[model samples]
Target: MGSNPAAPIEVHDLTVAYRKKPVLWDIDFELPEGRLIGLVGPNGAGKSTLIKAIMGLMPLLSGYVRVYGQPLEDRRELVGYVPQRESVDWDFPVDALDVVTMGRYGRMGLFTRPSKEDYEIAMACLDKVGMADYAKRQISQLSGGQQQRVFLARALTQDASIYLMDEPFAGVDAATEKAIIELLKELKSKQKTVLVVHHDLNTAEEYFDWLMLLNMRLVKFGETRDVFTQENLRMTYGGKLHLLSEAAEKVARQ
Candidate 1:
């Protein structure tokens, strides 16, 4: 589909490379506002790379990205990001509450301390992710799921209009997954846009209202029911889709 000026995220001809080897090629798509979007593909398909590109963390070899029809730098405050759990330095010497408090830095004046309200907001966000009890615990001391929950709390503290999350569900327990999906739905209800880099084919259809299939390039971008087809799966995954196809079929049947 053509770009939507009113879309939460509009990426056009985006290309990213490392050491002159392309990781993402000519990616172009506009994400609808206030919807749950899934970015799915095989390993090395550059799903995480795409998220970083939109967040302006990665240098683009070509094209551009816009948030709410404005340059990312102009609307940076409106976007929140949650990097993959694996990418975080969990061993950092900081408590869960301290980590969540950092999310407010974007809104705070430089060199200024967090106000009481900021701390209250951070605590509330931690509570929302079921980690208020562990707010004072060192991040390195928490379990994998707990660490992820703390990061989610950090993102919530931003209270941005759009959120770009990288595999928030990876390696989490079922309870954490349930909690995360519930929180994502709540964000949607509040008319906030969320984009997640996801790997679970089994739960993708159930989790996202929109899907963007990619394999270093755009395969399809549309409603989940329209884009999550066997043909598109084959095109996106090729020989890697045999088992994933069976799982997708099961989800469809359900």
Candidate 2:
């Protein structure tokens, strides 16, 4: 599950496949509703696949995903998604504000234009992410971190209770990562649930309250402090090591 029902996103027995090959298997967990949760794993471990399946971005082999106690698709407004920075073209013509306004497109309903209120909400979301000054700037001109912030602002504009972010910190500098972490903390303060697909091992404990460790299957899901241990880290990133360490990594990095 993504987060608590009282909190934000939830998933049960989530299984996903790519081209008939299973990528995720029987993942079940509850995020602490309004807190930040981190999804950590090796490459090809299906971290991004988990969020995508939950978001209906692709079909799920089995399992369920809910936002605010309802199926996500039925209650789309209660959810927001920030895809990877590499997921889209930076050269696209859309400006920062224009991206944020997409959040309201759903609320505006099909075949209609945005209203004045939509603009206000989009501006507010941009401001929330500290990008109001660059609302009109083309995305290509921004740095990696700024671009990430803009994407986050777009998600915020949706005003959803749950946020699913894929590799939010992938290409950003430390300063940008810190800034984004701070913004996530602020979202927690507002009782919004956030799930981030994170790869950096160094900042795991410091940045997230909950962790979903995966490798094409649910390895472990619980409090970051309890679940993040020497043995687990060994299992999670051991392949990078040698001998016994490498073997453990093999079992974990399914």
Top-scoring candidate (TM-score) = 1
Per lDDT, the best of the predicted structures is 1
Cand. 2 Cα-lDDT: 0.82
Which ten contiguous residues of candidate 1 have the minimum total lDDT?
A: 245-254
The sequence of per-residue lDDT tens digits that candidate 2 reaches over residues 67-125 is: 65788778888888999889899999989888888888988757789888888999998
- The runs of at least 3 residues in candidate 1 whose Cα sits more than 4 Å from the true structure, single-residue gaps closed, are 239-254
Scored by CA lDDT, what does every candidate get?
Answer: 0.91, 0.82
Model 2, total clashes: 5
> Using Cα atoms with residue i matched to residue i, what is each candidate's TM-score against the true structure?
0.94, 0.88
> Compared to the true structure, candidate 1 yields what TM-score?
0.94
Model 2 ranges off by over 4 Å: 1-7, 238-254
| Model 1 C-alpha lDDT per residue in residues 1-254, reported as the tens digit of each score | 56568788899999999999999999988888889999999889999999999999999999999988999999989999999999878888999999999999999988899999999999999999889999999999998888889989999999999999999988898788988998999999999999999988878888999999999999999999999888898888865676667756764565
